[model samples]
Target: MLTYLFMGIALLAIGFAVHVLKWNILIAYYNTKPKEKKNNKNTESYRKILGYYGYITGGIFFLLAFLEFQGISVPPTPVTAVFIVWTMIVMYYAQKDDEDEK
Candidate 1:
């Protein structure tokens, strides 16, 4: 349980570090205008949805971790699965974005 909590915290910390370094692909995608494309509205909506997903996932992990720490036992498998899926999705987007840059 503690390991899962630490892992969740580490993931959130890494995300914050990425934001601080201004290396977040989603943010870049949201702000930069594409030379060939003209639909800013779609990107804007994507950014909003991604932002909400991040907040909601982080909050869920934090809450579950806190509850587990307070003697309320919570299964870690689901949390781990969620984190893994989220990481995979982010990596996919990142690679796709990188390919687009070229």
Candidate 2:
């Protein structure tokens, strides 16, 4: 029972993060204007890339949760922890890119 509840919550958080990131990307893409006659000039590719990385990271976290829910032994969390940090560093660079463009 508790496992199910925890898994449900983890999945929900992951889903919500992915959904919000994608929505932001779509909204930014559609509602913006060309810069100097180039679509790439002012585009927020950083945010889009972050969205993708976020999806992958969140999915892995949710996978761990699912394994727990299914009564399967989850591997040690070190790899996942490293992956999370890796994603975070990429996200930091993405943010830097966004800032540099501004």
Candidate 3:
């Protein structure tokens, strides 16, 4: 129960930081790049997508925590699946080459 709550809060914080504050420090692959090569102008759209992902997943975690508090038992498998699928979608959008810009 507490685990879900913590995860939900953390995700929400990360989402707020990334989406509202425009902090890219928490992004995965993008964070590892050199500062001079970040080229954030070209990646704003993808970052927004990632931020949305965080918001959604965080909401799910919050809902799960609430449900658990209500004495409802939910399996973790479905949440795992959701995370995997959403992550794949976000990564695809983030890493896809921008042929139109060429």
Each prediction's number of clashing residue pairs? 0, 0, 0
Segments in model 2 whose C-alpha atoms lie over 4 Å from true places = 1-43, 75-80, 92-102
Measured with C-alpha atoms, the lDDT of residue 32 in candidate 3 is: 72
- The digit string of per-residue lDDT tens for model 1 on 1-102 reads 566566557656555544443334635554465655434334444444455555556667778878877899877677678778985787477546656755
Model 3 Cα RMSD, 1 decimal:
2.3
lDDT of each: 0.59, 0.55, 0.79
Worst 10 residues of 3 by lDDT: 93-102
As for TM-score, the candidate ahead, 1 or 2, is 1
Could you tell me the lDDT of residue 92 within candidate 1?
A: 70
Candidate 2's clash total is 0
Rank order (by TM-score, best first)? 3, 1, 2
Model 1 TM-score on a 0 to 1 scale? 0.52
lDDT of 2 by residue, 1-102 (tens): 344345446545544554554344333333454555235543446445645565665566667667777888766567557876886787577557656876
Number of the candidate with higher lDDT, 1 or 3: 3
Better of 1 and 3 by TM-score: 3
